[model samples]
Target: MTDKRIIKSSKVLVTGGAGFIGSNLVDRLLEQGNQVVCLDNFATGKRENLDLALQNKNFTLVEGDIRNYEDCVRAVKGCDYVLHQAALGSVPRSIKDPITSTDVNIGGFVKMLFAAKEEGVKRFVYAASSSTYGDSTNMPKVEDIIGNPLSPYAITKYANEVYAQNFTDTYGIETIGLRYFNVFGRRQDPNGAYAAVIPKFVMQLMAHESPIINGDGTFSRDFTYIENVIQANQLAAIVSYDNIKELQVGSKSVFNVAYGERTDLNQLFNILKKNLSEFDYKISDVNVIYGENRAGDIPHSLANIDKGKNILGYNPEYCIQRGLEEACKWYWENL
Candidate 1:
């Protein structure tokens, strides 16, 4: 990991800093007393998410798009590290418009990489996705084994891993890719058609509305919390630049950031129902309505976080139930 001392002293640029995970990372980095510059175009990222960070003197928000090389350059200048969190997310959204998704996720990622490279950013960490494990049907997905992408969103993220390797091999720039699995927590938008399941369900229960399960409720995922993701980013940014070279040269070169366990929709529903019941007893009676399965969703997704554990010294502090309980409290007050 880059030295903790160096990370604290560093000025890091977080692309997509107004989005769910990015905004949370900005909060944590600012808490650590690091100068954080957030670059976002307010596409998927909401301005309200950065409210508290905006009040911090050390925080800077650049309203920009990564797809534009000049915007990428503006965001990268004078930064010690670059955390690439900006991307067009959601499988259904990508399916609706693959071209736009490709332009943002893949095209924008390359632009930021090049910008960081030119600016001599010490380390580059990006948000990779578990969807890249596409169609593999593998339980407890390991980093090395991956299958053909099932959606345009998956294709873009897989391309990111390949490109990160090439960037490291060809340009000698240090890069780290964290393949996130079902991340959720505070500031996670639950309103959109492409909202994440946990927050979406929480908001539904808050309104006493029935949440529709996309299948028989057997589909499962390793629902990681936002804090764990923030921890992974901090660790990724703190690695010694030399260690990054060794990792890029040696291992599978990508790490899965997750809870290393899976929870099916039925279990998730039960967990949310149980926790939210503390606020309203009627929530306990909210029935789930099952529907047709999503076209591109995997039956189950579990991450083998051995790489993150052994390499990054990561031990996720929140399990599913704990994360759910905390998220429930946040949604109860905020939603």
Candidate 2:
């Protein structure tokens, strides 16, 4: 448990602002009386996701790509803080095209880092991935101890962590990295070949279709809520410089943003079915289909969130069930 820190009124840039998680962060920032600018190229980000945010007077959307230095420079201007969430986000997507993943996740990240540093931004907080824990077999992953990356996507994300470690020495900028677990909630895309399990399952179950599990359903994850992730970002932005330094591992200060627990795919299926049943009883009986395990996927992932609690004062408000219930309601009404 940690004491909460309030975000002050400031100009902030959200790199992938038109996407699922980025859009949510934009909305929350606007409500907190902050000036928010969202930068997106619409490559994987959707235009419709910014509908509500576009309506906010405090929100400014920058139509640009992180891959371009000019665009990054343009977006980072006059920003007090940067929330860098832009990247090609899926393991399968990366395996299919490692070049694109490397270009965006690695190259694009360095571009943003320089942009923030050039503009003298107060802090640079970006999303990291739990996939960095690859091949470790650690029950509850800690920040300092990590294993070799399993896939191209994981490799790229871990590379981001490595670069961020040298920011203070290389660029004199404060940086915080959030190693996010399987984050799910409202606005998270439920389509595409790389769609996450929760929303995809919800959408399929709503349509009375059986979900195809990628593995035998034994693979587990820490399935964190979007609100908790949002809080993590908010808290990270305002973290004290000394505290930020204290959380450093090999020069990078990263925290695992998760629910601090685990849920296997089979349990996830049943949980979604149970939650959706309250909305429509008929959907409860929908069966799940099991398939072969994915090539680069790990068997289990859980996080040790003590570092975040002790340092950033993060205390997650929603559990998996509560998040699933809310997500079900949103999908029922919006989908």
Candidate 3:
């Protein structure tokens, strides 16, 4: 059995705790007997995400924005571990409003780092992105090799890694960045224009609406499950400390949190459609409109998870199909 007791009694602060990934992380932390403080502005996150955690005695929900220094300071104070999951995600959203994305993703991230460092937190584990691979056409992207960021959102995420390294080198903060692939599971919003593809497609299919497939439907992704991401965050938070730096705390270094597998959009759609068809036989031939290709999206993305496996003992439990099935079920019932 996994040692879920590692974080017991630890006062942890999770920014964006009301968001999908952040709320999930908060749930896990509360389950482990940790005193979790959730700070979210709710720009994109919903209050419903933290409903379960609110019932826990150890969980405290703070409505605040990370961009504000006072809020960051208040949230970071007395926290043992800081899991920074707050950010404005989505490339197209960033492309449409680069300033808002920059202010929140980059500016807010830096503010959190400063506050965490000042508060003398034990460790900082943050959500990085596979989008950092940017224009690199490599089949399996490695951490050391990266390409120029194709979009403003990618640039902010990449800047986070650089800032983390800088904090380690200069301020002596302990930090680890988990580069997540296309993560999907329950609680992912499906109604927004900036919604992720999996939830968006599942919602459309369930609503008996046409799901638009961007590009040729051949574009692939290493769609990771939300549970795997929660596992990675826990591992990153409590890894044995060896050479602790001001920026990085744990014994293990940065790692790619993914299943190390590829699944194209076409295959993904078919899997979800087939699974949902069990409920409604006549749901076949749901119109799939292939529109113009997205600007910041990479043609394909696959991660080499050897680093995570060796360092954090990270093992992903679900593949794209399994994750999509669960996600589709949630959308069918909820959305």
Candidate 4:
């Protein structure tokens, strides 16, 4: 049996709590009997995501931006744990407007950290991205070995780790960074210019549009599910050890939050087509247009999740096919 003592009485704050992964974390936290506060600017977060939580008295919603110090301060006050998930994600979006991405991703993160430190939060856990693994050709990306960042977005996320470590060393804030690999699930927006692959494809297939494959469909990702991220956040929030002196606040001791598996684009497409074919057989096609390879995209990304499994007790319950099925159902019903 797992000990419930650590989180049972904690007051939690989830930044960007109205977004896909953040909202799901809010649900899990509230289910475990924690007093949860959600802070969001609604830049990318949808108001409908919080509909279920609004009925719960234990939940509070704060309209705010993390880039503003006062907003961060107000949100962090009296919170035991902070899950910072607010950021501008996507390489194309970042490439189009690097300034806004930097402001929200880097500037907002620093402000959140400073506020968390001042508020005396127990532990600060933020969403880190696998994009930090940039141009490195290694099959299974390890935490220690990283290559140069290829995009402005990658640079901002990498900078968050640097600032996180600096805050830990200079101040006394405890922090853990989970490098998420292509997280997708329910409540993920599929109607945006920067929509993620799974949701985007599901929507396209449902609408009878060809889901554009960026390259020759050989590109692949670990494609972690959102539930795994929720687990990581909860574990990181309550993780305690006797060695406080040896602990680094911004240590950037990162872990790959993935299932340690890889699925190529073509394979994933076939699986999606097979599953959706029950609804409409005409959707099955091997005719994805081969566009120019996107800039700043890595050829293949696989995570070595042993560290997460051993240290954080991370066990992902869904692989890509299963996850995509759930995602497709959600999109089909909602969109």
Candidate number achieving the greatest lDDT relative to the actual structure: 2
lDDT at 78, model 3: 93
> How many pairs of residues in model 1 come into backbone collision?
6
What TM-score would candidate 1 get against the native? Answer: 0.96
Which candidate order results from sorting by lDDT in descending order? 2, 1, 3, 4
Q: What clash pairs does model 2 have?
A: none
Candidate achieving higher TM-score, 1 or 4: 1
For model 1, how does the per-residue alpha-carbon lDDT over 1-335 read when each residue is reduced to its tens digit? Answer: 23342358689999999999999889888988999999999988999999999999999989989999999999888999999999999999999999999999999999999999999988899999999999997777988778888999999999998898899889988888999999999889998889999989999998999999999999999999987888888788775656445554333567899999889999999999999999999999999999999988888999999888877877788898888888889988988
- Error in Å for residue 39 of model 4: 0.9
For residue 55, give model 1's deviation from the true position in Å: 0.9
- For this target, which candidate reaches the highest TM-score against the unseen true structure? 2
All candidates: CA RMSD (Å): 2.1, 1.6, 2.5, 2.3
Model 4: per-residue lDDT, tens digit, 31-123?
A: 888899999999999989999899899999999999899999888889999999999999999999999999999999999999999999988
Question: Cα lDDT of all candidates, in order?
Answer: 0.89, 0.90, 0.86, 0.84
**CA shift at 243, candidate 3, in angstroms?**
6.9
What TM-score should be assigned to candidate 4? Answer: 0.94
If both were scored by lDDT, which would come out higher, candidate 1 or candidate 2? 2
In the predicted model 1, the residue pairs found to clash are 1-238, 1-239, 1-240, 2-238, 2-239, 2-240
